[model samples]
Target: MTNRNIKAIKWFINTQLLGKWYNVAYATFKVTSKCNLKCTFCNPAYYSGTLEEGSTERLKKVIDNLRDSSVVVLSFEGGEPTTRPDILDLLGYAHDGSFYVMLTTNGYRLGDPSFLSKISERIDFLHYSIDEYHWNLKALDNLCKFREFGLKVNVQTVVTRYNINTLEDKVKKVRECGYKILLMPAVDYPDSKVKLEPDKEQFYQVLSYLKGKYGSTLNNSWGFIRALKGEFPKRLTSYAITIYPNGDLPYPDDINGEVIGNLSQNKLGELLNSYRAKELRRKMMENSARYEYLHLQTASFNSIKDLAEYAREMGKWAFTGKA
Candidate 1:
């Protein structure tokens, strides 16, 4: 079996059969918070360049920590990950590690052919963030250009109340380019005054319709589609975890969970098994219905059917390079 397949099987056994729910299936590593765009819907601390970035060596240490943990997929995120000077080195290091590496970016730096060429081989998947809020709608017109770099591009668009009607156009464009697009609802951060969360029912209807028309081209699984309407079966805190720029884990997640420990300072296995982490997980479970982290919500598999569907989708994308 492939190394990736082994990791996936181990994660499934640990989290599913063994009842070790905290075993993570995915890890979003916030490499840096230095982003060029100032999307109002985004949190400033993550994108305003306010958070100090770790050195290449320090970042590698955290990657090592995750390698020892049950993380199957390691996604590099940012204010904009490209903003970091040593991003290529970090990507290469993570790419060589055990996890399936993915890079999430705003497509700002991807305009450079040199940059794309360097990173294309380093990451297993490229998550291009584009939407009306980013003011880079024109980037969608050139989705085909990325295919030359030999990178599987997945366009991630934020669905909002204002732009819900325009989703079909974006999906149609993505379909024409033979690429997949992941649609996530616009979440209202705790500190943000502007409420951008879409009407739940309308959101579900639009996603369901798109899923029916496009199938796997629209990366929302049946379980995740139901989650759009707030029908989550249980909290998926252990399914995925988000790491800060400084290697600090925001416990179960970044949304409602607290920082239990730093991966750089301590091993991820130890921290996750700590009393503080256990207590926080219990506390978050009491209010599971209120968490708004779309990624975490999607990762929270509602049923075996949903989990199987998602696994098949990811397997195809990872092995065959098709959505």
Candidate 2:
């Protein structure tokens, strides 16, 4: 590749393309598990999930293995990221000015203008969740108030059968609230009892409208659309890793997939290799119903193919209306 092309490729690898690469493009920093609200749909298990965090020193060791790539973004989430005592210090600790720092929050805290002012200084993008779990479409105002400093704010609305029909109107109103919006498919969470999966036709019809307005910025990608359409060819592995609060590593924490070694005691690269070498990877790869579901939501794999498959399954949909 030419110098310009190489730079362009690396940029994509760090951002949009990181999902496909084994390298860490996004780190969901679970600052702490203490949340301000307990949504009915959120599992108590995830909230009670491990509470350990890698210190700055250990975090740097994780970064060292990143090879020639820089971690493009580190997302701070909860219980409530703002609840963590080291919130500001952790923000300052990781601010190298190269990567973007973002947070996915519930907006109960952002209504305080004083806190908004402080957070706007370090966080690049602020994402607020609105869904059946969050149970309201009205928190957009709190996010919009931060516009004065040019802080990027985005909306994340998870779609379910209960709310799918109303998404269009909510989308327009949220757009007027002044931040970009993201339409997400509700994952198969236990508390939901899997009742929230949108009807396939209604879901796609919603996507038809979303794609019309937001283009590629609609959060869910075309591949995600294809998956919702049941075009998934075979099970896939995830390139992403989730190290819980207490430092235990779970293969696909979102779906309660499988457990791998903990980050505090074992390294990710070595653990992946050894786990697959034990014939466990083949068991999941060959197709067992239980493993297939686990693989879909959170599968542990030994190869890049696993990550690619997982990315296709646990696909992400995020967008900014930065104009």
lDDT leader: 1
TM-score of 1: 0.95
User: Could you tell me the C-alpha RMSD of candidate 1 in Å?
Assistant: 1.7
Model 1, 1-323: lDDT tens digits are 75666888887887777878777678899999888988868888887777767888889999988887788889999889998889999999888648888999998888789989999979999999989999999999988888898888899998888999999999999987778899888878878878888888998999899999999899777777776677765645547778999888897777777888888879988888889989988887777666555444445553667788887887887778767
Residue-level lDDT of model 2, residues 1-323, one tens digit each, is 33323433464464344543233344565656777777655556546635555565554444333222333556667677777655666665555554557788887777777777777777777877876578555664344556676667667787777888777676665556455566765555545654666677778778877767755345444544554555443434433445555555565443544667655566655665664423545554454333322233222332335345434432232233342
Off by over 4 Å in 1: 234-238, 294-299
User: Considering every candidate listed, which one attains the maximal TM-score?
Assistant: 1
Candidate 2 error regions (>4 Å): 1-21, 48-71, 190-194, 233-237, 254-256, 277-323
Clashing pairs in 1: none
